[model samples]
Target: MERMRIAVAGASGLIGSALVRSLTSDGHEVRRLVRHEPRSADEVRWDPEKGRLDPAGLAGCEVVVNLAGAGVGDRRWTDEYKRRIHDSRVHGTAALATALASLDPAPRVFVNGSAMGLYGETGDRIVDEDSPAGTGFLPELCVEWEAAAAPARDAGVRTVLTRTGLVVARGGGAWGKLFPLFSAGLGGRMGDGRQYWSYIALHDEVAAIRHLIDRDDLSGPFNLTAPEPLTNREITAAMGRVLHRPTLFPVPAPVLRTVLGEMAGDVLGSARVVPRRLLESGFVFAFPGIEDAIRAA
Candidate 1:
């Protein structure tokens, strides 16, 4: 394996932390761009909201991965919160791309974090990187989110936008928020629960990212999901089965619409996305099945 110098923004977050661990443990030089003064050698300081980063700190880094963003489900989707979500991603991305473009020794690869929401609610359609981007708030966000990375791309960086799926892990993301409710027997299918849930185990999620980073031929929007896409009802039932609990509680569509508003579409709609490129690139999944993922998580 080629040892390289890497820098990751949002290293405190779940996926970012996992990537940092994986990169550093593999004998690569990994540095984290943090919001506060870094306490270690492998850390740099940057404030995305203020559009500030240490250009000098980024020197000699060959790979830069931007994972900074406002959490989508962290709060109710008020207009202000929505704007915050959009601005956070756009501004952070713009700042990084601009910084990288100005560098004399620029990073060769820039992995930009996007979401499967870029495809909107495609029902049963299996969209890939070449598919036309859909319309809707999320799709719009992704469109702009990706546009913000143009500066780096124009600077000759090999840019990759990971249109990621629901990442199931131990502490956070979709599974973390849902696990407690399911374990307490309060979990159930929301709405019709027929929408496809294109989810990936966190292990594969991180591994595929590392794979993309190492592969120079891979670029553009890559759907980072599993081979199998399960429905909401299926995921709920699987969780119950894993814990030997019953999942029968139901959240009506009306209630979801009222609570999540525009987000209701994402919460209830489907994105049966497939990683066409990952399979083509010969990457293997560590936990391909949700049952194995839930049990192991």
Candidate 2:
């Protein structure tokens, strides 16, 4: 792959940080769009909430990857926090997209972040990139989040909406919370354990993003998940098997709702998403099976 200058928003985030390391290791120049004052030569200041970013900062970049957004599972979804979640994604994406679109020689591609929560509760039904957007807070939020990137797309940039699933990683995301619990032998199935979870290993998540960046022909929504979808029960078993612990207990739905508030619904919701487009595009996953993903995490 040819080395090129790339600008990344959310460079400090879990996925973003991983991507930055990957891009730099590949000999690409990385410019980080930060909220605070630039602390280094590679850093540039931008406030997504205020719709402010330096257009000149992105002048020579070949690609712009927007992974800026508030984490959904970071806190209880109070009305205010809910608004923050929505605004962080929608507004941040809009700010970056608009800025990128206005550049004299716009970047060749704009890889925007999205999530599988757009499918909402699909029960046992299989969903793909072609599936219709499901209803509910997350789905609605995702719709607007993707729509905010319209400017870049409209500007003729090859914009790719990466609809990511639960990223299994030891350092961050849901797996970060799960590792300790399971290690302590307290981890068990969530709710009824029948809810399907579409997931990808952290390794594959970064690799897939890089694949999207390289494959200029691929655009629009692409589901970033392992081909095989597993139920919560299966996931629990896999973790237990990997850790040599017992998967005997199951958390009830009501308790989860009581504890996590509105976030519990997402926890118990089923989304059997598949990576049809990615498969067709010849992107092979490093860890496709649940056991492999859990072990990697």
lDDT of each: 0.88, 0.92
Candidate 2 residue lDDT tens string, 172-282: 788888898998898899988999999999889999999999997999999999999999999999999999988777889999999999999989999999999999999
Model 1 over residues 1-297: C-alpha lDDT tens digits? 789999998787878988989888999998888888779988888777667876888999999999999888777888999988998899889989999998987898999999998888889887887788789888999999999999999999999999889998867887888989988999999899999999988888889999999899988888899889999999988999998889989899999899878788888898888989889989998888989878768
TM-scores for the candidates: 0.96, 0.98
- Give the runs in model 2 whose Cα sits over 4 Å from its true position: none
Best-fitting candidate, scored by TM-score: 2
